[model samples]
Target: MVFWVFGYGSLVWNPGFEYDEKVIGFIKDYRRVFDLACIDHRGTPEDPARTCTLEHIEGAVCWGAAYCVRGRPEKERAAMQYLERRECEYDQKTLVDFFKETDPLRPALSGVIVFTSTPDKVSNKYYLGPAPLEEMAWQIATAVGPCGNNRDYLFSLEKAMFDIGHEDDLVIELANEVRKVLGTMAKEKKLVGSPLKPLKSQTQPQIPTVQLHLLPPEAVAMDL
Candidate 1:
């Protein structure tokens, strides 16, 4: 069976999976979203520290590349394990979605993996819009994982955008802005304040109040 993995977010570059081909695939009703989400992989189950959001953009579709792995049963299994590792935050559940490539001439390719987590699991949801330039910039500048740095992501997207000759002022501008901000962060020793704290403040807060006085005779008549 051919394994199809969706590359909506950062997975485009660092999927940690082995694949032979990464082709641009189109998914209907689902566009890339930058809405932030706090996920378990990065933090405690009660409070996921940080993660990106992917909301459904109606009528609009996203164009992302997918990778097909050339491997035997064992190697493929290993690759799948790698994917699961990433899904730890998404509740270890993923959907196999099919898509049509943008290359009107090329045949449809089964490439791309979509991860769906429980409603509570996703801290925040976002629709297709300018990416979280700040978040991405921080990640790149910090170089937290195998992906190395957030600047790399920005550069890759910038290069890809130029290669496609598709000019998205919003994306491009965000990319540049992220680069600038990251540069500032680099100049400083570390980022001040917590980035994920903002997400946790969303939980509904309850307020208690005491009645000052009872209703008058008019209210008693209405009750009667």
Candidate 2:
């Protein structure tokens, strides 16, 4: 049997393991949500960063990449071990169907193992449940942990989704909000080189003001 793993969030950009083949695919009946709290990779326990999770949403679909692990039994075991260590926070796994982007009408593979955290509010400590995009953005904007800045994670995922010709509206909108908050923080700290340029004051050209570019309606109207 070919071992396959589905990556929807960070795995989309960084699988952190070796795979024989990677295919762009989508999982049905679930949607990507930034409702999980990151106490390790993107934030400390004291201040957690909001991360992505596959939440069960009827008639919904989540676009991501599925990696196929091909090797001898020992090699495949090592690959699974590595992924489990990387995805330690995720406490649940479900066999789901994966549909390839090239032929989305049919299932490319069935019984593929997809890892995800429990959606229950009482059971999982890292599960933050659903919150407003702005609130989630704020958490992701300011939090930094061992891996790197939380904002970088969001930015990278946004770019990755775009690269795959899939515009996740939630990710796109939340990332923009996070950029706004980050821009304000940068102004306060006098940090430069942010992708969103600081506003230039006409009277005081030397002083940089914070002004974030809102995503145009056209951009938001792309395939969701």
Candidate 3:
């Protein structure tokens, strides 16, 4: 059986896995949002970096790449293991229908796995939920980790989307905002407001309980 995985964030640019085929496509009813926190890859425990996570929205379409691995079970297993470790921050392994760019109305592949965080921050510890664009941009601009700076992740995704002929508006806006923040910092000859320090006055945003729709039996049956 062929195994399929969907990439919307860093995976779009760096899948870091072996695959038989890659198809550029979009998944329906889901939009990418920079609402997830990363403490290991792109940030420290004290100052987390904002990363991309899928937010379910009506009539939304998230464009990305879909990779399929077949012909050998070991190859597919290795890819899944690597992704599980890389996407450890995500709490859910969502199965989403993938529609090719050439035909958006019909699903080109069913049961494609997508790593996503639960909406409630309590349930998903890494989930940061929504924040103002400026705040997010500030975090992205200043935050750095072992992998690299958070801004690079955002910028790389923006460029990757453009290369694939589908530039995400939200990504572009956030990348531009981060650039502005960086520019301001450079002009000031210092970092902006000591972003590394915890903000005592900042309160956590109220997270609503979002009941995610369950996948069909067939989809669940295809789980790795």
* Maximum-TM-score candidate: 3
What residue pairs are clashing in model 1?
5-112, 5-113, 6-112, 6-113, 20-68, 22-66, 140-149, 140-150, 140-151, 143-148
What is the C-alpha lDDT profile of model 2 across 73-165, one tens digit per residue?
887899899988887778998899999777878999988889899988788988999988778888999899999999999999999999988
Question: What tens-digit string does per-residue lDDT give for candidate 1 at 90-125?
Answer: 552445455654454444653345765544423423
Q: Candidate 3 on 101-215: residue-level lDDT in tens? A: 7787889999999998899978888989899999999999999999999999999999999999999999999999999999998977765444576576656676889999999
Clashes of each: 10, 0, 0
* Pairs with backbone N, CA or C atoms under 3 Å apart (clashes), candidate 3: none
Q: lDDT per prediction?
A: 0.54, 0.88, 0.93
For model 3, the superposed segments whose C-alpha errors exceed 4 Å read 190-224
Q: Relative to the unseen true structure, what is the C-alpha lDDT of residue 59 in candidate 2, on a scale of 0 to 100? A: 92
